[model samples]
Every structure is written in structure tokens, then in C-alpha cells.
Target: MDKQLLERVTQPLGHPSTSSSTTTGDTPGVNEPRRDYETGTGPSPQQRDAINQIFALLRYNYHNQFTKAFPDLEAVKTGKRLWLNLLAEYPADVLLKAAERAVKECTWLPNVHEIIVRCDLASSLGVPDSWNAYLEACRAPTPKREQRWSHPIVYLAGKASDWFFLANNIEEVAYPVYERNYAILLRRLLAGEALDLPMEKGLPDHVEHPLPRQEQQQRLRDLIADFDHPGRS
Candidate 1:
């Protein structure tokens, strides 16, 4: 979050852009986010540079508005530290992006929760909010593996919690299970892990055992009986 780390995060992941290549220019604004930060060692004292830059952007952009909100230098420092604590779990650069968006969108200086919400939005992207994610998992069509999910994390969470448990339980019981599973998946996502669902295994091209018709019927009956009283045998 410090200046050096901010510089590292702001740098393009690859070659410079054509405009930059064509002419010498000042570095991009400090508030510009490097999404690559998602893959970096998490927030530390150095990461405070990103937090500092966000405040700097707000102070400059919001002018007297930010000053009035903070009132004094001490207040500003306290506010920055408070934001860092509240938002430390997120990548520093993503928080900067959220700050940048707030500067654009807010008529007045936004609050810490507003900024945190933006960071969550940025982190989750296409994924729904936790409640909505739970609803999506609950309402997904049967043969759930074959259902088209908005994101694999949703399916992954539902699978981890057991689709039948989710379907049978009340939200008070089910939601926490889904939320916990979703949170684990969300962190994995933020850490840049792929969350693609596993493909459903299908029948082999040829049967390993060609049962006689009567035997196959008898086996089906036995399987249904076992399902009805799984503890029996």
C-alpha cells in the first residue's frame, strides 16, 4: 500500500501501451489499480501506500468537501487507518479502484462502508451477492450438475454444502452453510484460482457387464429398495 508497492501495482502486467511507447509522459495516476495485486502477497504496511493514494485522490478531488469531512490532519490519518483495517482483506489495488469509482460517482465524499461495498462489487464481478447466490443455488433446476450456473463458484458452493441439504433446510440453517462455502470459494477466486465446475461423468461407450433383461429388472428393484431404506443393506 505504500508508494513503491503502488508503483509496482500500477505498472502494466506486460508491455507499455502504444501511447506510452510513442511518447514520454508522466506515470499514470497513483489511484490507477493493478489487478495483478490480487496475486501478490497480501496487504501489509507497504500496502498502506495504496490506501494513502486513495486518500490523496479523495483529498485532491473532493477538495474542501473531504477536508470538512475529516476536519483535521489527525482526523485524516485516523480515517485512512480505519479504512485500511476495514478493507484490508481486499487487494490494495482493488480498493484503489473502488476509491477511484467513488470519486467519479459520489457528489459528496463517500463513507467507508460505501467504498467497501464497491470493493466487494469489484471482487465478485459477475457473481451475485451472498443472499442472491443462496437463492440461485436453491432455485437451480434439478440435474443440478447440468444446470447453467451464473458462475462455477455458485455451483461449487452448493455442491460443497450438499444440494439436498440446501433444498431441505430453512434459510436460517441453510444460508450459513452456503455462505461459508461461498466465502471459501470467493477467497479462492480473489486469489486467482479457477473455480470451474467438474464435468459430470457419463456412461461408458459400452457396458462392462451385459446383464440379462430379467437380471437388470431385478437389480433395479433392489436398488430402489436400498434407496428407500439405505440403512437396511
Candidate 2:
């Protein structure tokens, strides 16, 4: 987020010739900046410099500390390459924060892998706000009787699916509950069944029932019998 660093990375390359002097088979213009195949845009000079800056900062601040911690510590000759690889894998902010955290926590110089691990840990600390909001919305009351499904769970599942689509954080929010129940919920949605998700302490629990109480009891007994008898009907 550093303005100077951002400018350095994003500075535009010189324009290539708009002239038609060259023939169709001629080589590409030199002034035309090389495009990143993945992004289709020219790479920024600042991004390149930032990669070196990060490595330099780490070396300057922690080289001695690292040497003191490990007397046999070898010179990090490939630190720049390693750091550049890290930059490719992570955003600048994430790498910077990871480096800062490593510096604070490590007694010796930390390796690029260690900093990356720290970044992963930091990333896993919480779900995004959008996911949290979606979860919260799942807890909201269903619409009025005439306008909505009779079953709150069915309504919730529909809403949750819609929320997941909009959230862009399905991997974080969809887990043991959502992943497990998605198919069953989809069935209920398609069948127009009145879904009664078991509630615990006023919050939704995972038990889903598309059938009435008698049917559920019968199903439970049948399941128990099946378990007891193995392959028997």
C-alpha cells in the first residue's frame, strides 16, 4: 500500500510504434513492454524493485541476528530469487506482514518458507466479513407465511446458497455443515418439502427432516435395525 512503491511497480512502459513501417513477419517492437501472459498487462518496474527491497530489508535487519543465532549460518546468496518467488506466490502486503511478523518472532534470520508459513497462519485466523454476514443472515427469520416456504431450514438453505454464490468465499464458509447438507438441502428445495432443521439453544442445528415425525421415527428404527442386522432387510 506504499504509494511510492505502488507507483514504482505500476509505472507504464513506453508505447510501441503505431507506425506501419514493419512488414507482417517482422519481429515485435522493442519499446512495447513485455506483457505478463497471465495478466495480459506489462509488468510494473515498481513491482520488480519492491521484490528486491523486501529481500534487502530482511537481509539488512536480520542477517547479523541470524548469524548470531546459528553460528554456522551460510550466506543467503539466493535470497533475492527466493524472495522473488515468494512475491509471485503472495501479494506484497501479505509478504510484508509475514516478514514483519517473522522479524518480530524469530531470534535468528527467518527463511522465505517460514515467512510464507506465517502468512498462511495469519490468513487462516478468520473468515472474511462477507462470510460472517452470510452466516448471520442465515439466522434471520423467514418471510411471512403467504410469501415464504413453511420450513425455515428450506428458506435458510436457499438463502445460504444464494449468499454463498454472492459471497465469493465459499471455501471458507462452506464446511462440514454446508458441504454435508448441500445435496439434501437441494433435494428439499426441489421437492417443496417442509424442512425442519433441528434447533439448539435457538440456533440452527444440523439435523434436517423432510418428513413428518412418524416417518422420521420409522426411518430411525429402520436405520437402527439395518445397523443391527448388517445386510439383512
Candidate 3:
């Protein structure tokens, strides 16, 4: 919102503007110097300016970055993995749609993190990727076409532990959805959550579930359902 501060902050450090009409040379027009946001910060002015610069860069390069990174279906697919963990926080349809887009449009290949981030985001949104081995644990009777993270409370906790271990083994980190769900599990555990644990973790406390099992699924389902569908009970 503050224009002058933005200008001051955005002014290039070494390179001066090369505009023909403007003689200030300090200006940031067509050949003008680009601001350095990563340096100098004792006063709040620097931080505020940094925020402004971040917004500007985001605004100007938002779509462009995506465009450059995702030129074809492969790129989208490659990039899609980054969002995998992120997808766990949302609805299944939403995640599937995102996956579909990536699977369809990206030209460049993405890293495992990309797929995992989407999964994480999905989990954060309440959508998790379920393999047949995973979904069988959801309490979905028949294990429907679309796999969900958890169905019941007992197996869910155990499954979460399993998944967390798997994630660790895979060396995944910071994927929002998975992290969110994982946190949720811990919070409930700390609260002495009531439910079953299907896994064979041999947890000493009746409070915390160590491994994922069928009983854990039931407990997790019940616990999550209480929060997810408060009106159902």
C-alpha cells in the first residue's frame, strides 16, 4: 500500500536504471537495477519492504513460474508429486482433480517431494492417497475405487504410524497434509484419546498408539469423525 517505501526498497543496489527519458539513473524502469531483498535489515522498514517485494514478485511471476515449470503433461506429473502430502488435507475430488491436471499438462518431470507435497496438502485438506494396502485399513467395507486416509479410529492411528515411518524411510519432509494429519494424531494421543489400535506397536500407555492396526483404525475413525462430522453423532 505504501508506494514510496516500496520504491526505496525495490531500488537496485548496484545496477541503475537505463531509461532514456529519466536521468535519475537510480530509477528501476527498463534497464534499472533490481532490488535486493535478501540484504540489510536492522529497522522494520527493511522487513516491510521485503514483504512488498515478495508480493510484487509473486504477482508478476506467479503464473509465469508455473508456466515455465509446467510446459507439458510430464512436467505437471513431475510437479504434481510436490503437492502429494498437501493433498491429504482436502477432499478426494479436489486432490484427484489436481493430480489429473498434473498428470495431463506437465512436460518436465517432478521430484518425489512434489508428489508428496500434493499428498500432504491433500491430507491437510482431509484427502489422502490410499493404496489398496492402505485403503484396506480405512474401514471402507469394500475398499472403494477412491482410497481415503482413514475410516475408523482404531486402525487409523496405527496406520498413521505406519505411514509416518514410511514417510521417514522415504525421507519426505514438510508436506503439509501428512504433517497436519500426523499432528492431529499426536494431539489426540496426548489427550488420552479413546479408541482401539490395530497395529502391534506394544504401546505402554493405553493413551498413545504406536503402530497402525485395525483397532487403531476404529479409534482413529471415531476420533477424526467426531471432529470431521460433529453433527453425525
Candidate 2 lDDT at 20 equals 24
Point to the candidate with the largest TM-score. 1
- Tens digit per residue, CA lDDT, model 1, 1-233: 34464343333222222231211123243122221222322234334666777877876787667767866544664576567668766645556667888888999888888888878874566766455677888899998888888888888899999999999987757876886787677766755687798966898998887899999999999999999998994
Tell me the spans in candidate 2 whose CA falls farther than 4 Å from its real position. 1-47, 65-77, 125-233
**Residue ranges of candidate 3 with Cα displaced over 4 Å:** 1-61, 72-129, 133-233
**Cα lDDT computed for each candidate against the true fold:** 0.67, 0.46, 0.37
**Per-residue lDDT for 69 in model 2?**
39
Cα TM-score per model? 0.42, 0.32, 0.19
lDDT per residue as tens, model 3, 1-233 = 25554343334222222322222223334131222212211112222232233223332344445445544434333333233223323333333333444445445443333444543543453323322223344334432323433433324543554544534443123123333454455345434465444444575756854876988899988999899888885
| Candidate 2 structure quality by residue, lDDT tens digits, 49-91 | 4445555556557655633432321223234434554555343
Candidate achieving higher lDDT, 2 or 3: 2
